[model samples]
Target: MHITVEFGGGAELLFDNKKSHDVTLPEKDKEWIIKDLLIWIKDNLLKERPELFLQDESVRPGILVLINDADWELMDTVNYVIQENDRILFISTLHGG
Candidate 1:
């Protein structure tokens, strides 16, 4: 499955400094969830401090996630089932301006 991942507000620093990435996860027995995707990103895409991006098995405090332009919090949050071609965005509010 293909997914679009976007980073902003300094979160890109952990992802090769790129603002967007088109990732393809191999088809498996089950659908991908936000929590599993987070682990995949941490293991594959993350290039810097893991703690800066994840905490408690989820996004760290002050980091915001949006799915298809809607806040993940309004969806199912970590349990939100990822869809093919979905657009997921992340922004770090913890960074100082």
Candidate 2:
């Protein structure tokens, strides 16, 4: 499946300072969910300080997750099923003033 993954508000610093990625997830026996996508991202894209992005299999506090422009919390958060061409965005709200 093809998806666009984005990071912002300082989260990009942990991903090589790049803000966007076009990812093609491998075919699998089961459908992909946000929880699974998190692992895939960590394994394939995260560059450093994973603790800043993920905590106990989910995003750390102070990060806002959006799916296709909608709040991920409205879409079931980490259990949201992924679909073709979905856009997943992670924006950090933990910035220092």
Candidate 3:
């Protein structure tokens, strides 16, 4: 399946400073979920300081996840199933002062 993954609010720094990624997930025997996407990103996209982006297999606190413009919390967070053309956005609320 194909999707768009975006990072913002300094989160893109962890991904080589790029803000958007067009990803084509490999076909899996089971449906892909946000949890699986996180792993995929860690393996394929994340360039540094993973600890700042993820915690316990999920996005760390202060990060907001939106799926297709809706809050991921409303879509079951990491359990939300990925679909074709879905847009996933990760924005960090943590900013160094």
Candidate 4:
């Protein structure tokens, strides 16, 4: 399935400073959850400093995630199942003054 991933608030820096990425997940029997997507991102898309983009299994604290422009927390957070063409955005809340 195809999905769009967006990064903002310095999150893009971890990904070649690009803000948007077009990603494809394999077609498999299991559903694709946000947690699994994170792993895929770390393995496939993350260009450098993975520690900045990942923590254990999910995004580190202070990073916000959105699904189809809605806060992912309202849609089951990391447990949310991803749909094709879904627009996912990651924004880091931490910034130096």
The candidate, 1 or 4, that scores higher on lDDT is 1
Model 1, 1-97: lDDT tens digits are: 9999999999999998999999998787988999999999998899999999999989999999999999999998999999989999999997886
What lDDT would each prediction earn against the true structure? 0.94, 0.96, 0.96, 0.92
lDDT score for residue 14 of model 4: 89
Better of 1 and 3 by TM-score: 3
- Candidate 2 lDDT over 1-97, as tens digits, reads 9999999999999999999999999999999999999999999999999999999989999999999999999989999999999999999999998
- Looking at model 3, report the run of 10 residues with the lowest lDDT sum: 88-97
Expressed as tens digits, the lDDT of each residue in 9-97 for candidate 4 is: 99999899999999989988999999999999988888999888888788999999999999998998999999999999999988765
Shift in Å, residue 28, candidate 4: 1.6
Would you estimate the TM-scores of all the predictions? 0.96, 0.98, 0.97, 0.95
- Arranged by lDDT with the best first, the candidates are 2, 3, 1, 4
Off by over 4 Å in 4: none
- Candidate 2: segments with Cα more than 4 A from true spot: none
lDDT of 2: 0.96
Residue 81, model 3: Cα distance from true site in angstroms: 0.4
Instruction: Judge candidate 3 against the unseen true structure and give its global Cα lDDT, from 0 to 1.
Output: 0.96
Model 3 clash pairs?
none
lDDT of 1: 0.94
Per-candidate clash tally? 0, 0, 0, 0
